[model samples]
Target: MDVFDRMQNGYLYRPEDPNLGISNTEQLKKQRLFNQTADHTILKRMFAAFGDGSQLRPPLFSVWGGQFVEVGRDVKIGPGLTLVDDAPIIIGDRVQIGASVTISVAGHPVDPTLRRRRLAFNLAVHLDDDCVIGDQVIILPGVTIGKGAIIEAGSIVTKDIPAHVVAAGNPCRVIQQVQVEKVEPKMAKSEFEKMRDGSLYLPEDPAILAEQQIHMKLQYQYNNLEPGDPKQAAMLKKMFADCGEECYIEPPLHANWGGFHTHLGDRVYANFNLTLVDDADIYIGDDTMIGPNVNISTAGHPIWPAYRLKKYQHNQQVHIGKNCWLGANVTVLPGVTIGDNTVVGAGSVVTKDLPANVVAVGNPCRVLREINDHDRQYYYKDRRVDLDE
Candidate 1:
């Protein structure tokens, strides 16, 4: 039998076979695009079988790509998602995967001779619907995670985890059975409200963590883009929830949500090292220009040290109005707003709202002067505008 046929039958086969290598090479190309592309729907097309509304967080390392992968509806996978999909990987509906989770289906033979010859076997991994896999969890070959199961963070799942149980630890075991509460849909607290209401909630909650992972992956792809690539602008538009026309941002842009929580208006230009702490919405109006090392934050934590251990964070929106210019090394704190036609001088820290038509400077930025006729005549001090030219 051919190598592929042997692989299907779970028999020993040369992984380095020429035909297999070619097939793998092609899949790798697709996999690269799959990981880097802003569109998650492309992943569904790449896999052997995929259900509707499934999304894979990028930088998703995979062996033999998605050739043997099968996913069900609404499967949300987090960043650093590694799948050794040499064998079948069947993931069911509504599976929430946390960041840095590894799921493998391929294993090497214990025999020395087989190991020397670079031989391996694969077993299908089945994750039933409504399961949650926590961060940094490693799921080994042939493991089955039952429906509604929860695998805690930093766990290594070596065997099957039965339905409706919470599992944790290395070589993970069942910690406890999850008691099902039949609460009304209206009574259940939404994740968005839990995040925004300043309430102490689980940041590592599968749904929330999955969103974080997706953002990180998209940011990774954006950061790695070569300068002058035609796809850069298009990719950015797709990555962000709202990016207006003619907006340009230099490389090394950092955001917690990969600009997903950021809204930029038309013709906004940001220099390098523009860091956005966009936990909540950050709005920038049209024709705004931001210099290097600018940090605009919307996320803040509690003052109590003990509360910090629980990783509780609160978010507030930051707004910058139209035609503003923020100079280098400026930091805008949470809940701050800058008004239209404003200028924030270099190395300024904006902690409070600044009104329109002013030149602001320094830490805890204050208005130095409002826009006047003299300011309009000169671009800088004594630099007269060549209006005739």
Candidate 2:
């Protein structure tokens, strides 16, 4: 079987030893080659500010600054994937991400008061090792995926996913357990040499690279102002009145925005192609970043069905706290609160409140674990910078 198949189905040649598969040198070489190519593609997207080349498989598309985030090794990011990390997004090793998937780690509130003022909030998303995410899924803010979990395609994850389980549906749930195996293979010396020497080509242009950087900075600035800055604050209020607090309006390169409500706190970042439907309040905290194509909705339809047809709608409140990271394409629904130092995984749909210092991921996002020193050390080491210092 091909390497991709092996990675998906596991390395087992027989049913009896499902966890065991080919361990030859040739197979290892092939995997390495695939990884190198994939890494190159991910780097080309450049969606995060703290991204590492050793962590991703390539041909990835980052809508914003995806190059800054940190990703683990053997992680597969499929085509048309979006990671929005206006905050930090931390991914673990051997994570399988499917095609057209989105991991979002930031969001805003829907409250009219906050929205009118152009205030935005953020939550973090985190994913552990050996998690498999399905295609076209949306992960919301403040979610964490446990080890060896599976998320079905087109599912909306807003809660936490336990380890060794399968979750699916619109608001993803725990369905079953997952079985994993290891495999190895041998490769030709020539192929191995090519992979090692890096004979691959990725789109490279200084202008585009510069633009991406500039965009990230501008977006950061858009979310960083305090209410005291009158000129900027007045502009922010006007912008919020015009476009809501969490709207994702692309700014022109090298241009200063007069008035719009977009503000991120210290150490906050997001992934690529993040579409913020900020018709309301959106607020984020310090040291938090979002993933690619993450859609944060501050506005929701009426549950009564009669109000659904209305052209205008009310807003909800969305809040994310400090030192949190969100995954790719995560969606945060209206009126949710995410506490400090949390992590959310990819393709999750957040529909509720998440407490401080925990890992939560899935539909209707739940608390997975309390944040400890280990979690802090893994994601925050050498990454946070104090501007005031």
Candidate 3:
């Protein structure tokens, strides 16, 4: 099948197949299930370090290597959740997740030609604890969600979410505030059991957490080393040894010395080919992701004569809130704050602050729609998942 068919069928097609453009229905279904199960296993093992009490409800799907995926204690996850982590994705205790929620924590360069040149870009995502994410929500990269935030079903989280607020809709807005009470141990156990058995529900694990951490450490080591010098390979190796649980950076490739700075929270992730340009500081909140080829950069040069002469001094700060997603090829400009739980569209140029709980797309990026119960109801009315309390 072609890329579109593969996406629609939720499976990867064989490259050598003569009829690669045709969808293999049976294979697609089987591959979808396999992918979900594999993602669930990876998530289980990765979070296994978090403690035995941590939980994950299955049917969670992801790409290779489980980049930037993190789970919290006593958490619940639902089906059809796609988390693309090239960064970090962190979760807090007692969070509830809904189905078909897309959390991507990575982005690529804005210039198409430069992107083809494998130039690094800068973007990341974060999500705090004690949040409730509704069904069919799309979270973009470089966003953060504060503690005790509630994202209404089908809402798109595009910006930062302040603590203890209820945000929803496309380009999600702060519609109201929610009163949150801690779940007692006994109650927590009961809820966990219900979710594990597929009765109660929750959102998927944020996939950016682990990936971001790995990317940050790799960039830090490379920044301190010499460029194009194989002698410096040992320095990079030693740095990885010292990283411990903070991150995992695979082998370096050509042009791996792009300066990128990333600051991560307690839990983070950075998937394959995650690039950074540390010419500026890129701060990512706890539990975020940086997906494959998900580039986070602060290396843009100014076009004006005076500023251009100075080569656009790299001192800007790109701040990403907790619990967000930066989709594939999503480009974020310098000095931008992606609000918590926000979703940015692929191939988008983010030039300003995106408020929390919204979905945005297109060049120059306009708010496409707000994720809400009405939208959720329209899309998933027939689904068995229960989003409303």
lDDT (Cα, tens digit) per residue for candidate 1, span 11-67: 887777677777777778788887667476667667888788776666677877787
Residue 375 displacement in candidate 3 (angstroms): 56
lDDT of 1 at 376: 65
In candidate 2, what are the lDDT values of residues 1-389, reduced to their tens digit? 74323322323122122242333234334334543464465353443322343433333444234533567776666545566544456777767776556787656556776565544444567888777787667888778988877787678899888887878987889987666442111111121122113222111222223323433564466556553444543343344323323323232111112222234554455554666554345677766777777777665554666555443245565677877777887888877788887788788898888888788888867777787766444556676543452
lDDT of 2: 0.56
Clashing pairs in 1: none
C-alpha TM-score for every candidate: 0.64, 0.35, 0.37
- Compare the candidates by lDDT and give the number of the best one: 1
For model 2, the stretches where C-alpha displacement exceeds 4 angstroms are 1-63, 179-389
Per-model lDDT:
0.83, 0.56, 0.56
lDDT of 3 by residue, 332-370 (tens): 776678777677767787787788778788788777777
Better of 1 and 2 by TM-score: 1
Model 1: how large is the Cα RMSD against the reference? 7.2
